[model samples]
Target chain A: MPILSVKDLQVTFDVRSAGSWPWTPPRKLHAVGGLSFDLEPGQTVGLVGESGSGKSTVARALVGTVPASGGQILFEGQDLAAMSPQERRRHRKDVQMVFQDPLAALNPRMTVGDIVAEPLVTHHPETSRAEVKKRVGDIMERVGLLPNLVNRYPHEFSGGQCQRIGIARALVMKPKLLICDEPVSALDVSVQAQVVNLLRDLQRDMGLSMIFIAHDLSVVKHISDRIVVMYLGRIMESGPAREVTLRPRHPYTQALISSVPIPDPVLEKARPRPILEGELPSPLSPPSGCVFRTRCPKAKPDCAEPKDRIQREGEVQVACPYQEVKDALAV
Target chain B: MKLASGDAKLLDETAQLASIRGRSLWADARGRFLRNRAALLGLIVLVLVAIFALFGGYFAKYEPDYVDFSLMGANAYRGVPSFESGHYFGVDFDGRDLFARTVQGTGISMLVGVVGALVAVVVGTLYGATAGYIGGRVDNIMMRTVDILMSIPFMFVLILMLVIFGRSMFMLFLGIGLISWLDMSRIARGQTLSIKNKEFVEAAVATGVRPFTIILRHVVPNLLGIVIVYSTLLVPQMIIFESFISYLGLGIQEPQTSLGALINQGAEQMNNGTLWMLAFPLFFFLVTLFAFFFVGDGLRDALDPKDR
Candidate 1:
């Protein structure tokens, strides 16, 4: 069975109108509208999207940081939305999250050892202090941090080192599933590779399932087993990582892939990439029908009609209806 | 089990690195505070004033309330500072030794300031953190209540409290504490509003740390720098308020005088040329206030995380 199966998950926020009276009605912001995905044990799913495409919201919903407004989140065949608060707390140990800003994710006042040992102490109060220390030390070493530096504060460390500390803290619980919310977005390029490689190594060693959320497609494609492309809170395309990046079916996915610059200067100049026009539509008032239609180059009059279904094409699930037309046009 | 020479050297170096001590946030702030000359001088003066308050009474020639009938009326000129007579600060209009009165007033003023500020910090931090963290309708209601309370004239409330509860040291602390916490709560709430959304707070929630624990462990500790700075500044304000109350004759009664009460009496007798009474208490009070302000300013610069 899949470790986590989210079916039609929806998250909405009530935002007050600017400069409006308190009595005025609040607008509904559909941050993650009907997102569904499954994570098998030890499988890594890369959730790629632009800013405000609800990528982080999906991670937040899974970790129970933000409440899911609708749908079922089945973890080990148990409905997370149906669980009591105590049960939810119990489940938190099995699922952990790594944040985007490394330093900001760590408590400035806490020692590195205390930060890493927090989850273990919180969940298993019966565990001995020696055991907690051993676990924290082991996780710190596993995350490429020196165990001797446990007394240091977050600010004393570099961004890369802080990210390592964050990773250690998350993995200290030995969680079955890890959600990384743009973990390396704030690091230098060299440090980004180190952290990503470290995460991949840790996953291989522990047989951990992960949901890696980022706006950088190249990084996502490098570390993910499968990739899910999202735009304006809806999945535009999802398939095997290699297939989704190489043979993108949806126009939106094709545009996203084309936007990635090749390393070789010659190939980078030769590639014809279509720059996406217009700003991302506000989540408070998202475009009708396929949310990507307003930005899609292959947009048709029918694309405006609301369609709640996603079509399957072999290994890929795509929201665009004109996949064949786009394919023919590409040829 | 013998290792290569290079590997052994590497291991030795690692041990040396491990043994190097780390500086905690408090340690770093203390270092910064020591480097600030103004703050260091202020702390030194404050300590001296505190020592005077605690031990100066023992050295006084007469008790604080001792009435000198010989120095009363026409013979009051003999009350001036004289090495032989041992009345270093002369006598007050009530025939009390000015030196003893100043020492006693210092102790009372310091106690009120510190105690009142402690009450404000504890009550304000908790109230504001709760409202800010819980947010939504609860925050609105809680903050609105603060606003309503803030609108009422605090001095009037203090006077009303003293009248209803009858004047006592504890009642004075309560009155000053109750009114002082309003501003503290507002500052705390504003800080918490920004702090609650910080990623560390979310990380704590994701770890399933209980809400109360999150507040105590994550929220409150992060607030320490600001709270400490604010509390130091608050101490002087508390002293001033207590002194004002005493000046109005509603505080400290007759036998037990405060700096404000002493100053009021000293001012009344200033035209009569008994200037030592006024000079002695005023000097102590002003020095104490300046010391607290300097310390508070130093703490703000020292504890500011951005400075690092």
Candidate 2:
């Protein structure tokens, strides 16, 4: 059974009253539009897209960080939208989020032990203070942090340790699923790999499921069981991470994979130059048919109508009008 | 079995967080704040001022309220009002001990200032936090109320309160406190609004912590610097306000005197051309204000996150 399911999710923000410089009338920016996905137990699903793809919004909405405009988020068996404020609080323990920025994620005034232990203290108010301190120390050790450093502030820790702190914060809840929003995007490349490996190890050991969101397809390809590609608030393609990375179906996906710089000089020079047509259109009023059509190299007349959803079996889903080409590319 | 697994997992998680606690923003701010000599000295002066208010008048030899018609306008107290005679500050119009009264009055001025500042902090924090956190209609309403209060003649409001309740120290403090908190609320609201949307706050919410706890724990703690700087800077201003009211003859009226009332009384005896009568208390008041300002400005500099 899928551990979590999100169906037809939509998030809209009213950007009314034109901006000061060249003000425009109130237009709604549809952030997350009709997105659906299911995460299996002990699986990592990478939600990949650029800045305005609404990947972060989906992550936030799943954890109830931001309220969903219209959607049903089912975790285990319960629907989050139907839960009361109090009920949501209880459910929050099952799904925790590891934020993007490590430095700003923590409470600046709190001790490292206190920041990690805060969730337990809040949810389990009956626990004794001494027990709380001990539990905090234990979690620190599990994250490979020395117990002696429990009292140290976040500033004393390096970027990698800070991400570890963030990860520990999520893990301390003993959650079934973790939502990591670009967790290692800020770290150096080498440190990013280390953190990614640590996360994979922790996920394996703890049996923790995750919804990893990031713009870097290369990193996600390594860690994710499945990858979902998004553009302008709509899913462009999705399937096994290996399948999507190795044989990209959509033109957009091919462009993205081709953009990754090859370390080998010969391969780098010989790689196909799949140039993107234009800058990704504003997600606010994205082009009609397929949201990626404006940039799709093989966009047909039918591609503008988004209702013409394209699908090919035994491979990732695609929304291009040139389904045959995409299917050919997949093989 | 489930419990043990979850517990073990929790243990691992908690340990990681323990390493985080030793390096937070508040600890750094507190360390930097403690090193500020001006704030520390201001704190010392504020405490000493409180002590003087509590047990200071006991040093006087006789009742300061004694009504001796024979000594009316004597320009001195207990003994004749004379320079170099150790009745140092001389006397008031009623020949009361000016030095004793001034010392005794320090308590009232400090009390009024503190009470006023406290009211301001409470009201201002609530107003500012509410206005800042919840934008749109509610924020607009609260801020507009503040604006209306600001536009009105504050002195008129004080005068109205005093006219209705008279010059009792309680009413005076209450009235002054009510007026002073408006600025604090505005400052607090502005700060709360800015910090409300910060990433840390969103992180707190994402963790499933209640809203109120977030406001108190995260939001308020960040505002400590603003509160401290504003409160310290406010003392001298509050003292001056009380003094000005006293100077206007509407504050801390008779036996229960204030620095302002005392200064006014000293000014009355200035017709005798004796400088010591007015100079001493006025100088004390000025120096106290100066110290508070130095401390307040220093604390502001040290606690400022932007400081290089």
Candidate 3:
């Protein structure tokens, strides 16, 4: 069974209308509208999207940071939405999240050891202090931090080191599933590779399932077993990572793959790229039918009509009907 | 055994590295505070003033209320800070020992300042943190209430409380404390609004920490630096407020005596040329207030995270 199965998950926020009276009703912003995905044990799924694509919202919903307004979040065959408060707390230990801003994710007032040990202490109150220390130390070492530096504060460390500390804190609980929301996007280009490699190594060693959320497709492709492309709160394409990057079926996915610059200057200049036009439509009034239709290069009149079914082309689940699997690398 | 030796050497090296690089936020702040010469002087003055308030009474030859009829007569000029008879600060118009009265005034003023600030910190922090953390309508209502309270004339309400409850220390503390927290609550709420949205608080929530625990552990500790700086500043404000009320004869009552009341009495007899009474108490009061301001300024600089 999949470790986590999120079926038709939705998250909506109530925002006050601009220039409205205090008593005026609020508008509904559908941040994550009907997102569904499954994570098998030990497999990593990369959730790639633009800035406002609701990738972070999905990660937060899974970790229970933000409440899911609708649908079921099934973890180990148990629906998390239906669970009691006590049961939800019990399930919290199994799913942990690493946030985007590393330094901001750590309590400035707390020592590194205390920050990492917090999950263990909260979930297993019966565990002794010594045991908590040992576990925190082990996790710190596993995340490539010196075990003796646990007494240090978050500000004392560099951004890359802080990210490792954040990772250690998330993994200290021995959680089955970890959600990383744009984990390395905030780091320097040189340091980003180190963190990505560390995460991949940790996942291999622990047999951990992960949902890696990022706007950068190259980084996501490096670590994800499968890739789910989202735009304006809906998934446009999802398939095996290699296939999704190379043989992108949806126009939106094709645009995204084209935007990632190749290392070789010659190939990068020669590649034919279709740049997406215009800003993302506000989630408060997202485009009808496929949310990506407004930005899709292959947008048709039919794209505006509501289509509930996601068509399957082999292992790929694509929302767009018009786009064929053209050779993405063809010069 | 060889592996154990290697591990021990590694541990030693890490310890040395830690000493060089692992200064905690508090330790760093402490170093900054120590480096500040004015703050050190302020601290010393505050400590000395506190010591005098606690033990200066023991050195006085006469009680605070003792009436020396000899000094009240034609020999009143003898009350001018004579080395003999142990009247080091001379005498008040009533022939009471100025030294003893000043000591008593210091104690009461400091008490009022500390107790009042304590109440403000506790009540304001909890009220503000709850309002800010819960947010939305609750935050709106709570903060508006504070705004409404702040709009009212603070001294008018304090005087009304004094009139109704009759001048007692408890009522004075309650009056000052209740009003003072309005500003503190506003500060705490503003801080909480910013802190609640920080990723660490969310991380705590994601780690299965209860909301209240997150407030207490994560939110409150982070607030300590600002709260402490504000509280230090609050102490002098409380002291000044109490002194003003006492000057108006609505605080501390006679015989009990605060610095303000003593200063009021001294001002009344200033025409008699018994300036020692006013000089002695005013000196202590001014010193104490300046000391508190210096310390507060130093703490603000030391604890400011932006500086780090």
Candidate 4:
């Protein structure tokens, strides 16, 4: 059985208007609209999407940071959505998250020692301070932060160091699953590589399951075992990483993969760019049938059929009905 | 190549650490603050004033309220500034020692100011933090109530309370503190609004830290810089407000004299050529205000995170 399974998860935000009128009804914005996926133990799943795609929302919901509007998030066959606050707190020991902006994610007032040990203090209160210190020092050293800098504040560290601190904080809890929400997006390109490499090393060493969310397909490609492509608030394509990136079945996924620049100039020039067109429609009123249909080059009249159904061809899941036909035509 | 560079980087980091030393945020803030002459001067003056308020009575030759009829004799007691015998700052109309009274009055003024400001700090911080953290509809309602309180003519209400309650120590503290918190709460609320959404607070929540603990530990600790600066400024204002009420004969009455009451008495006796009576009290009052202003200004510079 999968270690984690999100079944038809939904997250809706209420956009309340400012008015003097007392009877104004709040407008509902469906940020995450009925998305589902699964994570196997010790495997990394990259959730690829752009801003407002509800990729981050999914990460937030799974980590128990954001409340789900509706759905069942089963961790070892137990429903996360139905758990009480105390039960949810106990569940957090098995799961952890590393947020995007490293500096912003750390308390400026706290020392490196305090920031990393905070989770242990919160979740495992009976653990002695000396034990916490030893663990925190070990984890910090593991993440390439000198244990001597434990007394230093977050502002004293560089961006890369801060991210390492963030990583160390997540890993110190010894969680089974680590959800990194665009962990490298806010970093410099050179720094991004180091952090990604560190993550890959930790995941390998720890045998940890991970859900890495990022808009950069290339960044996620190196670390993720499988890829789940999202457009707006729904998954467009999902399968093994190489297959999804190399032989993308969905038009949106193909466009996204084609956009990643190949380092070899000759091949990069030779390959045709599957450039997508049009703005992503507002999630308030997404395009009928397919969320990606508005920007999809292969969008047909059948694409407006009100509900696009996911069809599995072997291992890969494609949301479009004519995906097989399209795949054949492309070949 | 990676291993060589990694070793070189480690050496570079060690060198950097050697140069930097271990400087704490508080130490850095103090260093920056000391560079500001005005703030430093204010700090010095404020410290001296606090000492005087605390230990000024030890130097008093006579009780502040003691009336020496023998010294009054024929001049109706008002005496010019002299260092003869025990009359340090001359004498008042009732033969009370001006220097002793001025020194002792610091106690009441300091008490009123410090206590009033403390009350404001406690109330404002709690109200604002709760409102800002538990936002949405709760925020709207709490802030609206604050707005209503702010809109009212606060001085009129203060005066009414003084009139009804008759200037007891409790009323003086309550009247000033209650009105003063209006501004403090607004400042605190604004700070909390900006801080509550910071990624660290989100990180705290993600780490499964309880909401109350997050607010108390993370949110409130970060707010200390602003709160300390604001509270220091409030003390002087509360002192001034107390003096103003007392000046109007509704504050510290009779045997319980404040700097304001002393100044009022001095102002009345100025025409009689007993200028020493007025000068000493006015001097003390002005010095106290200046000390507080300087200290408050210094604190603002010192506690500012931007300085670091």
Number of the candidate with higher TM-score, 1 or 2:
1
Comparison by DockQ, 2 against 4, better one:
4
Predicted candidate 3 versus true structure: per-residue lDDT over A292-324, tens digit per residue: 878777788887888774889888998877868
Which residue runs of candidate 1 sit more than 4 Å off their true CA positions? A325-331, B1-12
Error of 4 at A302 (Å): 3.3
True contacts kept of 3: 0.81
Q: For residues B139-194, could you state the per-residue lDDT of candidate 4 as single tens digits? A: 89999999999999877888888798776878877788778787887888889999
Alpha carbon deviation, residue A237, candidate 2 (Å): 0.3
lDDT tens per residue, model 3, B45-131: 999999999999999999999989887754247888987978899988888888999999999999999887888888888888888
Residue B59 error for model 3, in Å? 1.7
- Candidate 3 residues lying further than 4 Å off, grouped into runs, are A84-86, B1-21, B73-76
lDDT tens digits, residue span A1-331, model 4 = 9999999999998776677366677788888888888999999999998788999889889988789989899998999888987789888878889988999998887888889999999988999989998999899989998787888888888899999999999999999999999999999999999999999999999989999999999998888999999988888899898888778888778777777887888877877776777677888888778878778777788878886478997779989876642331132
lDDT of 1 at B115: 89
Model 2 C-alpha lDDT per residue in residues B66-101, reported as the tens digit of each score: 544665654443445555554545666676666677
**How high is the CA lDDT of each candidate model?**
0.89, 0.79, 0.89, 0.84
Q: How many clashes show up in model 2?
A: 38
TM-score (second chain) of model 1: 0.94
Ranking by TM-score: 1, 3, 4, 2
- Model 4, runs deviating above 4 Å: A20-22, A324-331, B1-22, B71-78, B305-308
**Quality class of the docking in candidate 3, CAPRI style:** medium
Tens-digit lDDT string for candidate 1 (B1-308): 35688899998898888754567888899999999999999999999999999999998998999998888884347888776776778888877888899999999999999988898899898888888888999999999999999898989988888899898887887788777788888888888999999999999999999998998999988887898999999999999999999999787877998998899888877888888878899999999999999999999999997887
- Tell me which of candidates 1 and 4 scores higher on DockQ: 1
Residue A50 displacement in candidate 1 (angstroms): 1.2
Worst 10 residues of 1 chain B by lDDT: B74-83
